[model samples]
Target: MEIKVIAFDADDTLWVNEPYFQNTEKKFCSLLEEFLPQHALSRELLKIEIENLPLYGYGIKGYILSMIEAALKVTDNNLTNEAIEKIIGYGKELLNEPIELLDNVEEVLQALQGPYRIVVATKGDLLDQERKLKKSGLSRYFHHIEIMSEKGEDDYLKLIKHLDILPNEFMMIGNSLKSDVIPVLNIGGHAIHVPYHTTWAHEQVEAKLDHENFRHVEHLKEVLGLMPV
Candidate 1:
């Protein structure tokens, strides 16, 4: 079947998203360790964050504040109104910073735009994804930009239905084995997996492929070469 819609995952697939989060996390973890070693603050905060996923979703802004709150609770650290305000200010600054895109990502997308109906199917904090998409200036390349809270077989099914495209005619391209590749394959869509050198722990999964429509590659740019467009 001739492919009609080509959907790409936004985070690690198109650019350097996980690294920014990792850097922020390391800084926050260090701060917690230095100030509140007695309570094992970082671990506790991570647990809280995980428990709050349904409530807060994913994003650096929420994460920063959550860390701060957890630190205050565990260490008996009386964060004054001024200190808390300052931390919020820092989080805002972090949000303003430009997300670094991977090399040739925009170029490759531009190259592929002429022939395929390009769409960005990313799962994350909606606000953060919006911020990153706008900042990257590549939003125009996509026919539709979907910011999903989660990715699974059902998500893929719903997306295909909404787009009015058959599973055999859609291709999902992404970096993670779990979110990007397996689920799409299970739903009978073609999946092109371009492995990133570094993957977030949560996004990583076993490199297992049992679907006939699945394809794996080493680089992002090579995807354009494989498809008709």
Candidate 2:
């Protein structure tokens, strides 16, 4: 495969992301525990979050709204302003969370920087993603950064076109099989799935994918072995 552009997913793939969200979620669930059990509250929050995706897109800000909405729904709109403020505070904390680079992330970027056009292709709020990239200090390795609202085939097609590269000449490395791997493969590009320890329920898919241009690696550094020398 003549892969010219190598796009890496920012969250979880290059740095710690989901766990911070999960931590915030636990705080959220506990805050509303009087109205509902932790497990049920988690489900309600997840439901509201998924429902609000179309309107709010994906980000800490959306999550804060969802938490507030969930609290109101579960409490029959009896939620106090203090609780809502706390929810917003949780989101702010999440936004300020430090960027913890994953193991071998920098090393892998250093190794691939010269041979390929490296870029960040991820889905999240533009400002937040940019903040994380800036905090990560690995921004210099990337030739471009594409923070997408969605990772659908059409979205990726547009990105490939913007990069002036054919689908076959592009490759995506990410943690989500649903967003990062399947869509890229469907668009006739290469994909490598380096799964994180946890994944959002909405991003989970149940399919045994078998494709010629697909690979599953246990670690980010292993991608070096799969690259064409």
User: Which one is best on TM-score?
Assistant: 2
Per-residue C-alpha lDDT of model 2 across residues 1-229, encoded as one tens digit per residue: 8989999999999999999989998998889888899999999889999999999999988988998999999999999989988999999999999889999999899999999999999999999999999999999999999999999999999999999999999999999999999999999999999999999888998988889999999999999999954
lDDT of 2 at 170: 98
**Best lDDT goes to which candidate?**
2
lDDT of each: 0.79, 0.93
Q: TM-score of each candidate?
A: 0.87, 0.98
What does candidate 1 score on TM?
0.87
> What clash count does candidate 1 reach?
0
Where's the lowest-lDDT run of ten residues in candidate 2?
220-229
Candidate 2, lDDT over the whole model: 0.93
Q: Residue 214 CA error for candidate 2 (Å)?
A: 0.4
